[model samples]
Target chain A: MYRISDQQVDFILADIKKHGIRIESLQQNLLDHICIIIEQNLEQHDDFEKFYREIIKTFYKEELKEIEEEAIFLVKSKGPFLLLSRLQFFLLLFITFIGPYITYDLVWFFNEGHGSVLPVEVWSGTMVFATFPLLVLLVLYFTPEKLDPLIPRKSKILLGIRPFIKIIPPTEKYASYQQ
Target chain B: MIYSSELIKGTLKTIVLKLLTDNKKMYGYEITQKVKELTLDRIQITEGALYPTLHALEAEGLVTIKTEFIGKRVRKYYSLSRAGKTKAKEKLNELSNFMETMISLLDIKPKTI
Candidate 1:
């Protein structure tokens, strides 16, 4: 077995940090794990830096920062919540808010006692109240990736008691790694 | 010879929790090796997924960690907390039931040892 020098260990740690892993414990975990692999595999004469880069590349698809992002995302998404995708949330808003108003108008139209035609204010009210919010939600849900800061295109949304609501940006790379 | 990434797509947490329950404690690499050994190298847990999940479990208070200095490196060991023990049982039961359901649904025959 090859023994890794302190300098080689330091080089690994710096490389991990430079790759964008911010959390200390996570950094250390990667350090120890990579060091063990090096000790077990690499011989003393081999190029440590090149071998290290080759191995770490397999850790992520795009970059190392995804791990930190995923860690933060999972922590925030925990506890009681209604997890929703983009389309589901949009439909939920429509059903909860707009559906009721449309139902009210339908019921009024067919009723024997009330007039067949809706008052102008009632039509205006539906147009005024429901349309604005519905449009806002539509825009928020469908906003382009660069333009939309709150919810990314593929992110999961959590609606809950504690945090009220949160948007977890998608990490499709590691999404399959967990349930 | 197969990698079970597709087969084990969503059961990483249950596996880890159960491992911690069976053993007193584990570190990141040890957990990976144990899984590989137990599964006959069919299931390999990646560092990208393992560290984050472990960190999340710690943040959620399902697991506790203690570090020891080994020369220049610090080795962190993880053990289940009181809540983690309860959680592990629940997750195991859940996964077991899910497997049973999958077996029934797919009408696959279980191989006898």
Candidate 2:
């Protein structure tokens, strides 16, 4: 029942910021919660400064950091899991497979018996070797928290593969050579 | 009497979900205060525990959050999602059955020989 003045609320908010809660949503939630507690103390005519100080003492900076860390972690983990579980991830997988197959078919149709391009077996082997690992890496990236520990090292390996993969000739280059 | 961390940890989500099922929606501080008041100060949920639980529930698609500004500060209100409502029912039933089972196992009925 003890109502706090706006200036007092501002001071409380500044105190929370000083504790290093950088996330906006978390800062807001903590501010409101602290304000509620301060006002509750006011109903008993508790000294504002003393009561506020006592309340702040309960939350060490590390604890506030943990809240922010957990929230940020959950948000980061949720997006990829949610996306991958839905049809979008599968659609991307489908596109990853069909896209290359369609291009190969188109190239074969255009270059039948011309012998101007790499054999289909060779091209297929190259696609599987060069691209399938990249695709698996993409799938791992979107997977949930269970695989989080593997992501950092896996990403470094993928970065190493980038130049080698890019060295493969574009399908368009192969098609144009026949023309 | 204050509850142990183990007890609170196991039951917190069920308590929060049941509270939401009854109240429709509640903000962070309100949920804490409501729980404290209902338990007559026997149980007080610290903010550290509450916020993380709420965020986890939100992440799991069991709760939806809506934000609105109160003066200059933003307040987030939480309510159950469709899946959340179903989960709440299932969880509450499970907790209730567990409690009854515990009581039956622990209670000593006197035998009138």
Candidate 3:
């Protein structure tokens, strides 16, 4: 017969609870499974720790991220909204970059191109330079390896124009954490 | 033995539900251990895989949790709800049918003339 320490049992139970598995009847079910493995390994003259590691290794042959993805998928087909919110932020980048440019262009056209040379050139040039790089960054951020081919080129170009959406926010470092 | 990953994947929910059905009440480690025992130590359940499944089942309202103090720590015990029991039966029946089909289809060996 194989024996599990109370501490080990506690660790396992804690992990299960943390993951949100609430079936108490399954508790002994898992224990029985592990007990059999340990017993077999002991019979074969393997050390307890070695046997334990082998069993764990066999069970989780895939990467941790893959396991997490499967679990998340199983739990809720519609994933957490936080990720969707991030995608929305990416979409907003496009609007921010293009909005000011369109406004500026329309104003210049209506005024018969009479805007101040220094300010107009400065503003328009700044928007162009800023938006271009910002769009590149967004593309790199959102483009998943497998889904690259699925993305429309028009969307990619629109994304490239997203950086000039607003004036770049000033950077500030908080000092609250300083001892 | 390393079974096809697909085989394990399809039956995970059924396996879990059946385990719960047998034990009545158990915690995380206990569930894994029971599966290993019943499978004759051929199948092992990992913490990485098990925790997420448990959480998913809880989220689906298939299981209910009760907490108990053990020494300095609290242990969460899991048991099937009424819905879980019904679901388990359905899943088990589905699995049994699947197994029967698989066995019938694959049990034949080719004859050498």
TM-score leader: 1
Compose the digit string of candidate 3's lDDT tens values, residues B9-63: 5677788888888877777777777888888877766665676677778878999
| Model 1 CAPRI quality | medium
Could you say which candidate leads in DockQ? 1
Off by over 4 Å in 3: A1-69, A78-179, B2-5, B107-113
Q: In candidate 1 chain B, what residue range of length 10 has the lowest lDDT sum?
A: B1-10
Query: Per-residue lDDT tens digits of candidate 2, residues B1-112?
Result: 7987557867888999999999988999999889989999888887876786787788789999898877666789999999999999999999999988877999957468
Q: Give candidate 1's TM-score.
A: 0.81
Worst 10 residues of 2 chain B by lDDT: B4-13
Q: Estimate each model's TM-score.
A: 0.81, 0.56, 0.47
Clash list (residue pairs), candidate 1: none
Better model by lDDT: candidate 1 vs candidate 2: 1
- lDDT per residue as tens, model 2, A1-179: 88777788788788777876786667888888888777666666578888888887775434456666545444443321221222344455466765666576567757776656667685786577647756765676567256654432222111112122111112101111121
lDDT ranking from best candidate downward: 1, 2, 3
Q: Give TM-scores of the second chain, every candidate.
A: 0.93, 0.91, 0.85
- Which DockQ values do the candidates obtain, in the order shown? 0.69, 0.18, 0.18
Candidate 1: misplaced stretches above 4 Å?
Answer: A95-116, A141-146, A161-163, A170-179
